[model samples]
Target: MRLNYILSDLGIGLKRNLTMTIAVVVTIWVSLSLFGAALLAREQVDLMKGNWYDKIQISIFLCTKDSGGRGCTGTEVTTEQKNRIKQVIEANPDTAPEGVFGESKKEAFEQFKKLYKDSPIVSTVTEDQMQESFRVKLKDPQRYQNLVSAVSGLPGVDTVQDLRQFLDPLFEALNKLQWGAVAAAGLLLVAALMQISNTIRLAAYARRREIGIMRLVGASNFYIQLPFLLEAILAALIGAAFACGTVWLGWYLFVKRQAEATFQVWQWVGPTEVFQATGVMVAVGLVLATIPTFVTTRKYLKV
Candidate 1:
């Protein structure tokens, strides 16, 4: 009998503030979805770096006589200097590491032409204009700065450039985007919480006369508080469900399907991970809802 009354009261309270309840659910759904996307993006970025960073090499360009001050002065790299550089690299097993390169200038130029076949400007350039470069793979990519310092001052060395330097700005931009998403999600979550609290407070005020009568009749505090708490739980659970559905649908359509079609570099979170994250969000929302409802009822319903 008590359970039935609680359920009936919860149903009526929800019906009375249907619009507010819907608003709270939508807000929670948006917040959780944004948070999930941000987390997934960060994970993908880390995964890509781990998988691809080691394969990248530092290109050390040698000076050539015809090469203008675009860093490579036209002083052709001498055979002795080339051998000395190669010897130094070979001696340092820790830094030079292991990787194959174009065996001769002809092979290097051919490869370069092939790479830039679509560019008309590159097609017009001749072999003499091309500068020789030593492609050095590192044992540990993280120690690339050490290799750069060691090679930068050598006689024939024109420039020593790491691939990571070019990619750093891109990763920094992604980090900023992730933080922005998190901030937006936080604001939305606060809005959802306030909306839920206000809805419950109004429900309690509407039942003040009945609560006073119940107090006079010596009803227990637990019995008086149960219905309001249950109402809040129901609202939060609904919001969580909505959030989970939105995340799943968005991932399926946007990240999994659309991203693969447009940007092959994008790696999506799998369904299993998405479901697990959604379950956590549901649990968090339920807890946030319960705490506010419990506090409001304790102060207002003095049964």
Candidate 2:
């Protein structure tokens, strides 16, 4: 009997504020979807760092004489220096690193020219003009600084460059975007909570007469308040369900499908995470909805 009454009250409350209920559902859905996307992006960044960063290496270019009096400065790297660098790399297991070295000056030149094939300046350059470089792959890419510091002032070494420096800006931009999504979701969540509070308060006002009658009949405060609280919780649960659905659909359509097609190497968040996130959103909505309903009914039920 008590459950029936609670359900009845919940149905009537939802009917009375149907527009506001829809608004709450939509708001929560959009907010959680954006939040989920941001989380997935963060996850992808971490995945890339773990799986791809170690594979990237630092390249040390050897100096050679060129048009100007650049001793081993501007010209092609000599055969002796190439052999010496190879020997030093193979000998020093600590710093030489274990990546394939481009032994012939022609090989390094070909790679450089191929990389800049579209450039007009590169079209005029020949293999003899390019310097040989040691492509050093490290056991741990994070230790790139150690290798760079060690090789910078060494003989025949012109420049030491880490691949991470080139990718830093992209990761920084992604970080900023993640924070922006979080801030936007937070603001929308606050708005949804406020709307839920207002709707529950209005429902209480509309039922004041019935509540007065209950109090006059010697009904317990708990009996009078339970139905209203249940009503609010029911609404919250419905909203949370909608939010979860939105997140799942958005992830499937936008991140997983689109990103996989565009960037084969990138990883996306899976359904399990979406379900977990939805469960959290539902819990939050339930608490937010129930607290205000309980507080508002206290004075009304007492009368």
Candidate 3:
């Protein structure tokens, strides 16, 4: 019976302020959607890092006839210079347990051919043009600077390249995008909260006379506040539901279907990540609705 009365009042409050309720719902939808996208973006970046970072190695390029390396001398690297670089890398504690693998000029040439086979310049390059280098795998890829700093000044060492350097900019950009989404979402959330507060205030004001009669009849504050709280929860819930749908659809269309298809070499976030984001959005939506309504009703409900 009490539940039915609360439900009835909830319906009345919702009908009485339909426009404001719709506004709150739309605000929650946009805010929660952005928030969920930000969460999914974070998960996507992590997935990419875990997939790519582990396999990346530091390549210490030796001087070639072209002299393209930063610290390289005019002449090609000698066998002794190569051996010395190998020894230094093997001796580093951060280097992976296995000995450093040296790629010969011929092997480098072959790889370059395979890589640039479709490019016009592949025919112009020769084996002698390739730089002999040591591929040093690290126990921790983040310790790349340790190896690079150690080898950068060594004789015949032209340039030390961490494959991570190629990836860092992309990851940083993605991180910035994630934070940007989060910032935008945060502002929208504030707007939603204010909208909810105003909705509750107006509902309370419209029902002030009834609230006074209820107060005179000895109705509790909780009973008086229940309908308004329910209204907020209902609007937020609808908004969260829509937000979850959009987030999932966005991931499925853009991330899973499009991105994963195009970038088969790298791992991407999938349904599991979307589900996690939706779960958070739903919780956030419920909280976003309840707190402001609770606060506003306590002050304005009159009962």
Model 2 / residue 145 / CA error / Å: 1.7
TM-scores of the models, in the order given: 0.87, 0.81, 0.95
Report lDDT per candidate: 0.75, 0.73, 0.88
Candidate 1 lDDT by residue in tens digits, 1-303: 878888898888889888877877777777777766766666666766775686678887777775543444457878877787676665665564455242356666787888988888776778876767888788888777776776676777777779999777887888888788878878877887787788778888899888888888888888888888787777788777877788788788877887667855534567767777787788778876888887777766664
- Candidate 2 ranges with C-alpha deviation above 4 Å: 67-103, 109-123, 212-223, 259-263, 295-303
lDDT of 2 at 118: 84
Residue ranges of candidate 3 with Cα displaced over 4 Å: 68-71, 301-303
The segments of candidate 1 whose C-alpha lies over 4 angstroms from its true place after superposition are: 68-73, 91-96, 99-103, 212-222, 259-267
Candidate 1, poorest ten consecutive residues by summed lDDT: 94-103
Which candidate number has the best lDDT?
3
Residues 156-275 of candidate 3 have per-residue lDDT tens digits of 898888888889999999999999999999999999999999999999989888888888888898888889888999999999999999998898888778874674877888878888
Cα deviation in Å at residue 292, candidate 3?
A: 0.9
Ranking of all candidate structures by their TM-score, best first: 3, 1, 2
Query: Model 1: clashing residue pairs?
Result: 64-74, 64-75, 65-74, 65-75, 65-76, 66-74
